[model samples]
Target: MFRSNSTTDCVQHITTSVELTPIRNYISELNLVHHSKRVFKLKLNFPKFIVICNNNGARLLELQSKVEENWIDLQCRVRGYGIGVWLGLTDLQREGQYVTMSDACRPRYSNWMRGEPNNGNGNEHCAMYWITRSGWNDTVCKGKINFVSTFKDAMIFCNNLGAELLELQSKAEENWVDLQCRIRGYSYGVWLGLSDVRTEGQFVSLSDARKPRGNFRNWAKGEPSNGGNSEHCVIYWTTRIGWNDARCTDKFNVACKKQKEIAYD
Candidate 1:
């Protein structure tokens, strides 16, 4: 979670906050790295910056491999940690106020250090794995140590065939999506990306809130009742051919989704 705040851009985790400013009149280019066990290098214009994204290790192993090597723990682990991404809002103009970048990753899990990201002196804008530590931290960007990055923009989490959490674009898309889930052997039910997780009826896609609710047809004719506000997750009810909100804890199949990779020039 790299964020830019008013004074500095500090990379924090999902829950923590940071401030940043926007640069103007940008130029752009795009390149894709399609290989395994390779450090992804993204060459963006500003100052000729280079970002390396990774995606081969398991959840915890991914973080560990970055910091622990040769049985020697460096000062910080440099993978996927940084306040590099510009939140839509920046503190460059307004100070001390900040909002989180959009949940483009929609992480299913997180490991954060306690009371972390104090942003001491406002220099710690990059996300890093501190030495002798189990969680993560925000630190100054300039350092000799390695850094972490992710290839979220170029990849989508789906089956090899590209089957994923159904995006309900229209009634027809919805109908086709059900078949995709069923073919995948999710007969019991399927977990949808939609949820009232943030608010009751105004359900939003868990991955990117900006995604319009679009045309989710009648909720199984009588579903998504909010269930006393206990149900926050949504799912496609196969039997009903309509949408339903359910307890997030209640196990069910899930739909995979990705947001349009946002790039500014």
Candidate 2:
């Protein structure tokens, strides 16, 4: 009887293992599908605004009826690129709500706090700048100055800052700066914004006196060595060096600058 029981247990173990094989394979396939789905969502759901500030500020702005459920899908168009106090304040203002001037983009500010307000209290009136649900965040500051508030009560804030804002706006529209992808065997670089040069060493000059030539030189040093009889240049932005060059056909991240008009329909 003992020998018979031992034989029975061995057969059961083999049967269980075989049964689990298909289940395991199914799980692996499911994970792949889940990952692909996530990438699809990201590509489809690109944030309109490159930057957001005051996590609480973002949350308060989202509370608007038009934004109640689909706030993340709303692309964020701010006054500037990257995260900074200017970008943060511009983001909040662009939302068209009353914001504490102090809440403007301070790098040290908390993202978590920005999203959720009054962690310390239940009754504090949230400071915000109000704008129509359909209005663009920058529109308030763009023309006619519809609402009035102070960045600080005692200090004077100038609208000339808006000129700088306009410059950033133009840069974004031009799409001249693009990011390049890493190549298989080469150090990462970007494509300059030029094409069809007559000479191998030719480079483009900046139209604006303040703008730097040679593809974000301060950011990408020792780049654009005019690699081996290459005559064309493409503009690109790099995380490590700001901007630099590679061969025209090389793939990289692109910064396309265009004024995106927000239409609430």
Instruction: Give the candidate number with the greatest lDDT.
Output: 1
Model 1 residue 190 lDDT score? 58
How big is the positional error of residue 151 in model 2, measured in Å on the Cα after superposition?
42
Model 2: per-residue Cα lDDT over 82-178, one tens digit each = 2111112333333323342344443232222234333223222222222113222221221111111111110111122211111222334323222
lDDT of 1 by residue, 136-155 (tens): 45544442221111112112
Task: Highest TM-score: give the candidate number.
Answer: 1
Q: lDDT for every model?
A: 0.38, 0.25
lDDT of model 1, residue 148: 18
lDDT of 1 at 144: 26
Cand. 1 TM to true fold? 0.35
Error of 1 at 215 (Å): 3.9
The CA lDDT at 15 in model 1 is 22
